[model samples]
Target: MQIDLQNSTLSSASLQKSQEARKILESRSGSGHDFLGWLQLPEEQSARVQEYLKIAADLQKLDAVVMVGIGGSYLGFKCLYESLKPAVGTPAGPEILFAGHSLDGDYHRQLLEYLEDRDFGVVVISKSGTTTEPAIAFRLLWSLLEKKHGKDAAKRVCAITDGKKGTLRQSADDLGFHSAIIADDVGGRFSVLSPVGLIPAAIAGIDIYSLLQGAMEMCDHLRNDKSDENPAVQYSAYRNGLYEEGRKIEILVYYQHAFQYLAEWWKQLFGESEGKDGRGIFPASAGFTTDLHSLGQWIQDSERTIFQTILDVEDAKSPVLQNQKNDGDGLNYLAGKTVHDVNRVALQATRQAHADGGVPSLRMKIPTIEEFQMGRLFYFFEYACGVSAYALGVNPFDQPGVEAYKKSMFKMLGKPGHA
Candidate 1:
């Protein structure tokens, strides 16, 4: 992946700030540094490939597998699974469904009903098994598994949770469910490259090895190349520089529908990491042409506090549009342009128009959307997020603000410890 910051600004100070942030990150001396396990995840997880592969292979025997988790657990794997799913048919492995990301009863009800007829398995992800959403989903799903497969249900369940202690770990031991460990240092938002994200991706038949290899390669690149040319450094510097200039919102724009969830994951990563200490750029996203009609007017003429980072996929695999020759609506000016051809032009046009309208933008181009490129993309943003948040003078690894809502919910629900 390549990042073009020509349309964006990067002051020397911000560039220096990025380099300093990198040093702090590399030295493991920054705030919340214990969570820097993500820095080594690609190499570390790559060594354990065979173990996850075996787990995936076992789960693949079922018709479907429900992945249960919220936040980082759900978003990272969900981003990869949705972006890489086969366009034309079922995955090479079992159908992978998701749960525990929300509290909608209707959705879980439908999910259970869907699984009732199919031979299914479960992979529940949580550090503490008592987290309200996934705990509820897991309880419901485990019950269904037990009802359908009886004592053998243990064979179909896998828990990825705290390594030493958690309600989930105890339950896994007691029930004899296949299990994996989430290292103590890795935070949920950064756990995508860890077993928390990879197990589900592996079960969905994604090339997790290639994904890790791509991430590892990117990691090495950023470590060796400390110059402004480094994509991660450049991205962090540019966005931080813009934030200083009153551009307080960063909108990640992509043309393909596949990147929609990726934008969501990016939001959680940056928002939760930096949106503290009364500072941080607001992260937003838009799917072009689709959202253009709805959000274009505002972005074009709204407050000048927003900038954009456009994700440009240079070679997205897409079908060519066939010509409609009847001319009833209009004459066919083009006969065989690919859909990507039209989308690329739209990207260029929108970028130019937005720039003309006073919105500075950055363009990040990847050759195509595939496992290897996606791995690189994930690591790129993650590494940059660390630098970006630290440069903003906040702890990038903790989400103390997130507990505010949970505290309220627990008290309202009359949970035992809340009062």
Candidate 2:
């Protein structure tokens, strides 16, 4: 992915700050340095990624696969799955489904009933193995699997959790289910390059090798390149610079619909990583034309505290030419233009309009919507997130504030000690 900072409101001072920040990161002296396991994940966990491919092959015979996870556990997989699915709509393998991301009883119930007569398997992911949503979803789904397949359920079930501990690990061992380890140093939000994400991507028929290759290449580039040339450093600096200049909210705009989940994953990554000490910029996302009608008004005129980071796909896979029409719609000028051309024009117009309205903008031009590009994009944001949080004088890895809501909910539900 190529990043364009020309439209951003960053000055030379911000670039200097980013250079210093890059030094701090490389020296491993910044906050939350111990959690840098994700920095080299693509290379370090290559063997495990291969194992995920083998498991995915075995699961291909099933009708569907349910991945039980929440938050970071599933967001990356969701993005990967949607980004790389079969372009023809006919998947070569089992359909992958997600559960445990929400607490809605009816949703889980319907999912359970939907799988009653189908051949399905389960892959449960959790660090503690007792996170409320996944744990509950696992219990319901496990019972159904065992009832449907009896002793054969053990062959279909797998667990990706704490390597040496966690309720899920113990359960997996006791029930004789296949298991993968989530290392102690790798935090949930950063586990996309780990088995937590690779396993699901593999099952969904994504190209894990290409994905890792892209990420590994990006890692090397970010590590060796100068701050001025490194996209991650440049992005962190610009974002922090805007934040300091009263741009409180950063809107990530995607012209492609497939990137909706990518935006969701990005929200969690930045939100959980930097939202401490009340000093981080609020991360928001929107799909062009869809959200332009809804949120565009506010972004254009409501406040000057908003900035935009647009994700542009440089080469579209499919192109459609506008049909010539003499009707009074005044669209004849677009007769020879492709849909992609129109979208590009819309993006440019939006950038110009927002910039003229005093909203600073940045753009990330991706080569295409493929696994390699997606992997690079993920690492780019991950590296930038770490730097941005440290630059804000906060811990980039921990999410202490997230527990407050869980505590309240657990107490209200009278869940043991929380009550």
What is the per-residue lDDT of model 2 for residues 1-419, given as tens digits with 9 covering 90 to 100? 78886666567877787777777777889877888888889898776776788777777779999999999998989888877775457677887888999999999989999999899999999988999999999999999988988998988888999878879989888988878888888888899989999988888878888889999988889888984877887898889888888989999999988898899999999999988887788999999978998998999998798898999998886566566555578777777778888998999999999888998888999989998988898888888888777777788888889899999998999989986
Question: Which 10 consecutive residues of model 2 have the lowest summed lDDT?
Answer: 318-327
Count of clashing residue pairs in every prediction: 0, 0
Residue pairs in clash, model 1: none
For each candidate in turn, the TM-score is 0.97, 0.96
As a TM-score, model 1 comes out at 0.97
Q: Pick the candidate with the highest lDDT.
A: 1
lDDT of 1 by residue, 152-263 (tens): 9999999999988989999999999989999988999999999998989889889999999999999999888977788888898998999999999999998988899999
User: Which runs in model 1 stand beyond 4 Å of their true positions?
Assistant: 322-325, 329-331
